[model samples]
Structures are given as C-alpha cells and as structure tokens.
Target: MNPASRLAQISFTAGPAALLAGWFLLRPIHGEAEPGPWWTAGHLAWLAGFAMFGLMIFAMRGLAGPVRGGRRAAVEAATVVALLGVAANLAQLAIALHAGFTASDGEQMRALLSQARAYPGIELVVYTPGAQLFFFAVLAMAAVLALLRRVTTVSAGVTAAGVVLLGVATLQEGAGTALAAVGMAVMWLGTLLLGRGPSGDGLPATTPTRA
Candidate 1:
C-alpha cells in the first residue's frame, strides 16, 4: 500500500495496543490512590493511545471510501464524534498525568483528583458521556462499513463487542483493568483483520473509489 494507507493501518493497530499496555501498567495500582512512576507511565501510554485513535478516525473515513449525500455525511459525522471523544480522553489523561506529577501521596492524589472533578462539567464531559462518544462512534463506523460491504460482519461485531467490554471496564476497579486489557486485545484483533485489505480478507475485494 501507499505511505498514508500504511500509516493508517499502523495507527489502527497501535492505538488499542497502547491502550492495553496502559491498562496492564495501571492494573497493579488500580485501587491505589497514590500517583507515582507507574501512574505517570500508564497515563502517558493512554495519552498516546487516544492521540493515535484521533488519527485512526480519519483513517476509518478513508476506509469508508468515496460517498455522496447521506453516506458521506454519516461517515463525516462519526469522524467528528470520534475525534471529540478522543479529545476528551486526552484531556482526562492529561489531568491524570498532571496529578501524577504534582501529588506526593495517596491522600494528595485523591485530593487533587477530587478537586479536578469538582470543576463543573468535568465529570460528565471528560469522565463519562464525552469520552464514551469515542466508543459509540467507532461501533457506528464499523456497522456502517459492514453495511457498505467494506468490511466483514465478523469484524464489525468483534469491534462492537470489544468497545462494549472496554466501556464496562471503565466502571469497575480491581478487575476493570484486566477487562480493559482484554477489550483492547479484542479491538486490536478486529482492526488487524480489518486491515487485511479487500479480497475476502477484511476489506472489500476491489479498491474503493476515493472521494
């Protein structure tokens, strides 16, 4: 493939892999209220993951191929929503990184986190609904691509399942990180399969007409 296509494939594969790595790094400190080396490293990985996801969004649009009217609009809208979610995720990770850097102990870390959460809309936007949009958008895009026959149903379903698990993983504590890791692994697998290109692989058999 061309350089841009190659880059997209790389980002698609690496984004969730980074996320899984972050989850693994953070698992040991799941309930720990303290910020330290592990915390810094984990959040840094997450930051990179979300940033990569931002690029992956546009890559997904490219995968959707050229379209007009509603199809194009839907793809574009999904892209925007995914990007917004990625931005929110990045912001959250940034806050976590800052807390890791500034806080000295568990108590201090809790206090810092509490104070940050106290900011209006931060909880809902960065923590909940906003960050969640990314998953929703991804699932939607997968579904759209499936409907367009750009990707296999299995790929779309697997991606949707992974997204759901990742969402649920966020709500738990001790085992949540493990669940997240599994989810990321599943997502990586789906994306990897999706990257196989057309011809009964993952993508369509013929090159999509570029928009």
Candidate 2:
C-alpha cells in the first residue's frame, strides 16, 4: 500500500478505538442518578471517538477509489455525509450532557433538560431521522464495497449486522446498547479490512524499479 492508504488504514483503526473507549466510559454512568466526573469523561470520550470516526470515514473514501464499480463514488460520498451528520449530533448530545451534569444541583439539571426539550424541533429536523439514515448509509456502503469485491463477503455481513445492532441501540438502552457497541467494534475490524488494498496499492516505501 502507498503512504496515503497506510495512513488511511491507521485512521480506520483509530476510529474504532476511540468509539470503544467512549462506549466503555459512557456505558456505566449513562442516565444514572448523581452523575460524577466519570460521567462527564464518558460523554467526552464518546464524542471524541465519533469525531475521529468521521475523519476516518473521509480517509476511507480515498482508499476505496481503486475498486471500481457501479456508483462507488456516490455511495462513498453519501456515507461521508451521513457519518458526518451522525458526528454532529453526537457533539450536540455531548455538549448537552456536559452542561447538564455540570449544573449546580438537581434543580438545575432538571431545568436544563426542560429547556432542551423545548427544542424538539431540532431533533425532529436533524438528529431523529438523520441518525437512522446514517445507519442505512453505512450499510449501503458496505453493500457497494461487497458488490465491487473491494471488501470480503464476511466483512460486508458483519458491517450489515453492526449497523442493525446500532439502530436497535437507538430504541432501547443499557445492556442492549452495550451489545450494539460490541457489534460496532466488530464492524471496525471490517473497516480495517476494507482500508487495505488487495493490490498493495497503499503500502509505504516502495523501491523504484530501474529501467
């Protein structure tokens, strides 16, 4: 693989690492009463992971270029857009949670939640449907990659399963979400596989051939 592809692979790996860290940090204290420093740390970790994943998604688009097929570019583009949208919402949520948790006491936290609820319109327009779209968009990318033989069949299947698990996570909370995080961690491996080129296109430090 070339330098760009090598970098892409590295970024892809980082994406999942960040996400897993975030989930680990956040899972314990999520929605718990008497939130503490760990709760804030968890949210920050999760959001940071999501932001890195967004960058990885963009990097993967370049790695995906060699594999040519029907609408490959379009699918990749849509995935970038959708994933960025997901990242944006994650940031928003993290901010809200941090603000709420930092409030002086219970009364202040409740007030913050109340004020946030007043803006349901934002969620309606963006986060609500956008997150669902992001899930399908990622699944679509996996399908396209599979069709193009850019990714292995098993990778595609795992990707699809991961997306579904994440979607299910949205509806429920607690253990189910943790399970979904595990599935997403698996999907990250699939993404790592996808980042590498079959032809060694992105390996670094190739010796030039003399004529």
Candidate 3:
C-alpha cells in the first residue's frame, strides 16, 4: 500500500469519527432559566462525543509518513486539518469541565445567575464566539485531511473548494458550521478521488507506490 494511501485510511478512520464525536456543544445562556434534565442531557452527549473525538485524533497521528513524493503533500495537508480538529475538542473539554463545577445543582445555577447579574464576567467567557469558531475550524480541518487522503481530482477538488468555503463560514458564524462543512466536503471529495487513479504510463497519475 502507498504511504499516502495508509494516511488516507488513517484520516478516514479517525478524522470522521473525531468530527462526529465532537459535533455540537451547548453554550451558556444569560437570564434564561436552564432548569431541566432534557436540556442538560444534550450537553452531556456532546461532551462525551468530543472526548471520543480526541481519542480518534490521537490514533490518526500514528498513520503519518513513509509516503511517496506525491503522497507527501496530501499527508501534510491532512495533518494540518486534523490538528485543528483536536484543538476544537480540547476547548470543548475545558468548557464542559468548568460547567460541571458551576452546574452542580439548582443552587449553583441560581448562584451563577446571580454572579452574572453582579459582574457579567462569566457571560463573556461562556458565550465567547472566538472559542466556538476555533473549535469548529479544527473540526473542519479534520474533515479536510480525511478527504484529502482519499480521491484527488473530483473528490479532492470538491473538498478543497469546501475547505475554502467552510473557512469563509468559519470566519462568519463560528467553527461549528465550518467543521460540519469540512466533514461533508472532505468525505465527498475523498470518495470521489478514490474511484479513479493514474495509469502506469503516468497518464492519470493515480496512486502511490505499494507498501
């Protein structure tokens, strides 16, 4: 198998899983009563997913190198994309853990609400768009890396286009949309790229050297 191909496999396995695992997280709401198990459950699920995603990224790092010339670019590209994804999960983990301390029970919620009323400092950190954007950007990059490893022409083209487009979105709405778009576009392009390869004569220029 080609080194690039192996990296592709690694990204495909871990990248997608990481993205899925860290999909959506909950944010703090000011002046709004968040007093319910149902609302809290969603947050818990998202946090769990983020943890699994972190593990997935750790797994992907082991798939690097030994790639042929052409494959090197793709592997590097994928690495860039995946690293951002890991960062996103780390941010979420921080937020989730902090919440545990503050959201212990009705008393805590009420107390935090009072603190927000008094100072509003918590609101700033809890609702900062920057953290959200950073997280999603990483997630999107993971998708891009995974997709990059797959097919090139159609799939790679599509994924690249997606990366740029999602990047734009990330700049706007935050990282969540960007990462979602990254995952979608990367997967689409990768599968497309995998469908075709180069001829031995160097016509299509498909495939890396066999492992």
Candidate 4:
C-alpha cells in the first residue's frame, strides 16, 4: 500500500485501541472519590486516547480526500458535526481532569459534577448530544457513501455495526470499554479493507461501474 493509505489504516486502528487502553487504565479511578496518584495516570491515559482519536479524525479526512457535488457537501457537513462532538468531548474531559487533580477534597469533585449536571453546559452536553452526534454523523456519512457507491461496502457495513455496538455500550454499565474496543476492531478491519487495492484483495475499493 501507499504511505498515505498506510498512515490512515494505522491511525484508524490505533485511535480506538488507545481509547480502549485509556478505559482499562482508568478503571482504578472509576468510583474512587478520593483517588490516589493513580488517578493522574488514568487522566493522562484518557487524554492520550482523546488525542489519538483526534488523529483518527484527521486520517479519516485523508481517506475521504477530494470530493465533488452533493457527495462533497454531505461529507463536509457530517465531518463538521463529528468534529464539534469530538471537541466538546475533549473539553469536558479536560474539565473533569482539572477538577480531579486540583480539588482539595472529594466534596469539591462531587460539587463539580453536580454543578455540571445542574447547569446546561459542556459536561452534560459532551456525553449527551456531542457524543451521540459524533457516532451518528459518522454512521450517516458511511451509509450515504455506501449507497452512492463512493465507499466500499465492507467499510460502510463495519462502521454501521460499530455504531450499533457503541450505542448499546453507552447504555450499559461497565460495558463501554469492551464494546468500544470490539467496535473499533471491526472498524479497523473495515478501514483495512478500504485501503486494500483490488489487485491486493478481491474486495472492490469502489463499486464497478454499471454498463
């Protein structure tokens, strides 16, 4: 494969893996109100995960490359929505990390979460609509591209499957990390298929033109 394709595949694969790592690393800090120094490690792990996720977004943009007409417009608009959600999620995580590290006592951390939920702002917004939009927007884009035959069927199907896993993961307790990990793995496979040329793999990188 070309260097660009290699990079995109790596980014797409590593992004979710980083997130899974973060989740595992942060497990220790889950319910601990007065967490030890280990909490710092958890926070840092998540930060790295999110950063990698950002890189994944960049790589995804590269995959899309150039576009024209309605397809271009759709890709651009959906990308914006996904980016917004990513930004919001990062901001909320930053706030939580800040609170966790700086607060003198558990009371302070508790207050922060309480206030965040009480107010209509980043904290609540991030996990709610922001996260939802991030997943749904990507799903929508994949669906649209698949229907238009602009993207590989395998890529679209895997992404849509991942979306379902993520949606279910979000609702269940203690399932987020595992579900996300599996989902991302599926997406990685899809992305891998996308990067493969017809000569390298039987799968068509693009749908065949109908006569």
Candidate 5:
C-alpha cells in the first residue's frame, strides 16, 4: 500500500483502539466523585480517538472511488455528518478536560460541568443526540460501501452491531463502560476487515497501484 493508504488503515484501526483504551482507563473510576488524573487521561484518549475517527471518515469516502450520482452523494453526506459528530464529541471532551483542570475538587468540577451544560443547546448538541450522529453516519457509510461492493456485508453488519452496542453502553454506568470497550474492539475488527481488498490482502479495495 501507498503511504496515504497505509496511514488511513492505521487511523482506521487506531481510532477504535484508542476509544477502547479510554473506556478501560475510565472504567475504574466510572462514578468517581472527582475528576483526577485518570479522568484527564481518559478524556485525552477520547479526544485523540475522535480526531482519528474524523480522518477515518474521509478515508472511507475516498474508498468509495469516483462514483457519481446518488452513490457519491450518499458517501459525501455521511462524511459530513460523521465529521460534525466528531466535532461535537471533541467539543464535549474539551469541556470535560477544561473542567478537570480548572476545578479543585469533585463538587467544583460538577458545578463547572453543569454550568457548561446549561448553555443553550450544549447538552443536546455535545452530550446526547448530536454526538451520537457520528456512529450512525459511520454505519450508514459502511452500509453504502457494502452496497457498492467496496466492503463485505459481514464487515458492515459487524460495524453496525458495534455502533449499536456503543449506543447501549451510554445508557449504563459501571458495566456499560466495559460494554463500550467491547464495542470499540468490535468496531476495530470490522474496520480492519473492511480495509482489506477483495483478495483478502491488507490494502484497501480502492487503493490505487503505481505504474
């Protein structure tokens, strides 16, 4: 594979791995009263993961090749939505990191976070439905690629399952974090499989060869 394709593959694999690592790091203190070193590290990992995810989305778009009409439009739309989701996620993480750094104690951190959440649309956009859009968009793009034969149905379905598990993980607390980690692992495997060409080679199916 070329440098660009190699980079995309690395990002695709690393993004979810980072998320899983973050979840594991945060799991021990899932309900801790105060933000501490673990919390800061976890948030940092998530920030990096989401940033990589943004790159992964664009790489998937490129994998869709030079198709026109609805196919191209679908990939492009998914790419935009996924990037928006990534932005929202990053914003939320940044807020959390800032709160952790500024607050002297758990109560102060909570207050700071609450104050930030109280901002108009911040709760909705960065916390819930808005941030979740990224996973949905990624699943949509995976399905589109499957339809285009750019990726296998199994890979797309596994990815969709991972996304669903992650959504479910958000609804729980202690054990849910573990679930989220598993979900990220699943996503990593799915993307790894998706990145392979038709011959089961490691390179992306749409990767171009040199003359």
Candidate 6:
C-alpha cells in the first residue's frame, strides 16, 4: 500500500458519505409522501450514480497526480458542478422552509410556490443545495467501489462511474434528493474501504498502476 492510495481512498469516502447522509436524513423536504428508511435506502441507491461522479475527477487527478491531464480537467469540471449542487440544495431548503412544505396545498402555500416557480431561471440561478444533495446521496456506492477496485484491474470502470455521477449533476435539474442518496452509499462503502486498508497509516494498494 502507498500514501497516495490512502489519501485517494479517504478523499473519495469523505466526499460521498457526507453527501448521502445529509440527503436521506432530510427527505421530507422533497415533498415525498413517505420518507421512511426503506424509501431513503432505495433513494440512496438511485443517487449513488451521481455521488460516484467525483471519482472521475479524482481518478484523473490520481492517474495524473502532480501533472494536469484529463483528471485535472475533470476535477475542475466536477468542482463547478459540485458547487452548483451545493447551491441548489441550500436554496431549495430556504424556499421550502420559508414557504413551509406543510402548507403547500393551501392558497397561501400555493402563492409562495407560484412566486418561486414563476421564474424558473431565478430558482436555477440562485440554486438550492437540496437539488444536488439528492443526486450526491447515492454516489457513495461508486466511491467505495472505486476504493475496493484500487488493487484490481477494474479501477478504470469504477473511476468512470464517478465521472458519470458528476456528469448528471451538471446536466440535470437541481435534483438534491438524488445526490443525497448516492452520497450515503459512498460514505458507508468508503468507510469500509478505509477499514479494509492497512491501518491509520495504511496505504490502499501495493503499487499504483496506469488504467
């Protein structure tokens, strides 16, 4: 195992776990009829696609460490997308809190929602972190998987999976619920991945190989 692998694994785990945990724990904000544990789990699985996205960025950076390559570019792109995700979720939460999701059905609630929805551009521009949070939730699965695959030949695919998560963040609506689920998967898997490694000073792989 090597130091770089350890850092990579840790970073991957942290990013995804933070994302998913935050999401499932707050699904009520999404106006879902039932936001129970089962629903949250299923949601987490779905969002895992996006949470895995950071891997594409980091993998490139990992493969091209200290040197800018596709990974560096990917990292840059993912950063922008991640920022949007954060912003979208925050904004949505603010709006929902202000309007009160509990009051969405009546005249007052409808009025507020209408105001926010009227100019869709306004919503997107300011963006709520909630939107991206949902997508990030499920990404955990990929991060953990990538860490597991670190010592194997399938790392490339795992890395690509991370990229896909990021890609969805960029192209889709500010879908925070999806991000949250994915992020959770990454967190659990990532922690396990870390535990599976050497020790606190452990490395993830014996040698770093090109994909």
Top-scoring candidate (lDDT)? 5
Pairs that collide in candidate 4 are none
Q: For residue 71, what is the lDDT in candidate 4?
A: 66
What range of 10 consecutive residues in model 2 has the weakest lDDT sum?
202-211
lDDT of 4 by residue, 1-211 (tens): 6875555556655655665565566567653554456556655665665665566555554445455677667767877877776777677667667777778777888787667657666545776767667677767667655655556777778778876776777667443366766765665565455434223342234433322
lDDT of 6 by residue, 1-211 (tens): 4765555555545555544554554565562423244334434443443344344334423333332454335445545555456455545545545554445344666577668867757555554444544344324323433443432223333433544554465467443546434534533454344334433343333343332
Q: Number of clashing residue pairs in every model?
A: 2, 5, 14, 0, 0, 59
* Candidate 5 lDDT over residue span 1-211, tens digit each: 7887788878878888888878777776774536888889888988999998988888888778778788878889999999999999999999999999999999999999999999999999998878888998999999998887777888888888888887778666432366777788888888777766344566555643221
Candidate 4 local lDDT, residue 46:
59
Writing each residue's lDDT as its tens digit, candidate 2 over 1-211 gives 6775555567656666766676676556564423566556766665665666666666645434543344666666767766856665684556556665677765676676556646756555445665466566667776765665555677678767766776677567642266768766876776666555334343222222221
From the highest lDDT down, the ranking of the candidates is: 5, 1, 4, 2, 6, 3
Top-TM-score candidate index = 5
As a whole number from 0 to 100, the lDDT of residue 24 in candidate 3 is 30
List candidate 6 segments past 4 Å from native. 1-65, 101-107, 126-211
Candidate 6 local accuracy as lDDT? Answer: 0.45
lDDT (CA) for every model shown?
0.80, 0.60, 0.43, 0.62, 0.82, 0.45
Q: Model 3 segments beyond 4 Å from truth?
A: 1-65, 68-81, 104-150, 161-165, 174-211
Residue-wise lDDT of candidate 3 within 24-97, one digit each (tens)?
Answer: 32233321334454335444555554454444343333332245554455555545544555455455445544
Off by over 4 Å in 2: 1-7, 27-35, 66-73, 97-101, 174-176, 197-211
Residue 102, model 6, lDDT: 44
Better of 1 and 4 by TM-score: 1
RMSD of 1: 2.6
Say which prediction, candidate 2 or candidate 6, comes out ahead on lDDT.
2
True lDDT of residue 25, candidate 6: 49
Better of 1 and 4 by lDDT: 1
